[model samples]
Target chain A: EPEVTQTPSHQVTQMGQEVILRCVPISNHLYFYWYRQILGQKVEFLVSFYNNEISEKSEIFDDQFSVERPDGSNFTLKIRSTKLEDSAMYFCASTGTDQETQYFGPGTRLLVL
Target chain B: QKEVEQDPGPLSVPEGAIVSLNCTYSNSAFQYFMWYRQYSRKGPELLMYTYSSGNKEDGRFTAQVDKSSKYISLFIRDSQPSDSATYLCAMGGSSGNQFYFGTGTSLTVIP
Candidate 1:
């Protein structure tokens, strides 16, 4: 079955540096999302993208966070500046249609020191 | 209060036993309920999807949602050791694409 795939399975960055997490959602999917889970915490929604624009975003998706579908197949999340509290596992998900099941990627484990 | 609440159990059950996992949410607008399974060091895998307050069964797994009570459950019958994983409950609505998740319940099905 086709699945969402993310690049840089693991990343280590210094505090105040920038990081970009990339994902290639299923080719036919129309809706894309980004979520994060802090260690020992629940998964938190970050943002949702559709039609090459953001449909929704959470409070955690503040000034430092931005998402771009620079190409037809690539969805990228960029953190302009990483903070220590930003360490977490980021997952990318996609759904083929509205109100459909969202499939998740293996996730990118980000560590900011 | 948290929007979604789960037991966060590191529960252990013998193989062939029944497993019950549950979650509660504060939002009443949530119409799409789903269960996701995550193994150690892996992302969540979709297990069950329920559109409204009803019961849905697939193989050894059953998903139940009670919109009136704002509760949902996932039951695994005749559980196997391979069923060990953390189960998360997710909720979404039609108004937007945003989704919410509960703290996962970790289960260990031992042989």
Candidate 2:
């Protein structure tokens, strides 16, 4: 199976600082998304992007959160200002079409101080 | 109530044991059901996917969905020690882009 790859498997930054997590989705996939799992919690969807625009976002995706498909193959999630609660395992996933299975990248563990 | 509910199990069983993992959902509009396995801090790996209701089997794993009951299940036969991980049940609404995931159930298949 084709795979999605995320950079910086682990990142640690201070509170109030900015951070960007990058992912290289499968070449043919058109829809991309970001989800995060806090310790001992279910994976929650943050946002979904397609056609270079966000299609849907969850409540957890507040003003501090943003997503950008910077180039043809890369999708990124940026936190304008990190908070302590922001620490979690952020997962990037992509799918060929809607209602289909999403393939996930290894994941980027973000640690906000 | 949560849209999706699954038992967070630290279910331990010996190799060759039959394992049953289950989830219950409240929404009737959900059109797709899926199960994923995550190991430690790694991302989820899709193990089985089914549409609507019924059962689908692959090798040692089987997935069943009963839409009328709003219940779904995954059964692993002859479980191996390598199967130890967290299993999450996820459902997709009619819109496809949005999905609801259950708190994963952790399982340890003892050798």
Highest-lDDT candidate: 1
- Give the clashing residue pairs of candidate 1, or none: none
Question: TM-score for chain A of every candidate model?
Answer: 0.98, 0.97
lDDT of 1 by residue, A4-89 (tens): 99999999999999999999999999999999999999999999999989999999999999999999999999999999999999
Deviation (Å) of A81 in candidate 2? 0.6
Model 1 lDDT at residue A39: 90
Which 10 residues in a row give candidate 2 chain B its minimum summed lDDT? Answer: B91-100
Please give the clash total of every predicted structure, in order. 0, 0
The clash tally of candidate 2 reads 0
lDDT of 2 by residue, B2-96 (tens): 99999998899999999999999999999899999999999999999998889999999999999999999999999999999999999997677
Each model's TM-score, in the order given? 0.98, 0.98
- lDDT (10s digit) by residue, model 2, range A18-110: 999999999999999999999889999999888899999999999999999888989999999999999999999998865478888999999
Q: Candidate 2 — which residues are off by over 4 angstroms?
A: none
Model 1 agreement with the true structure over B1-111: per-residue lDDT tens digits: 888999998999999999999999999999999999999878999999999799999999999999999999999999999999999999988754888999999999999
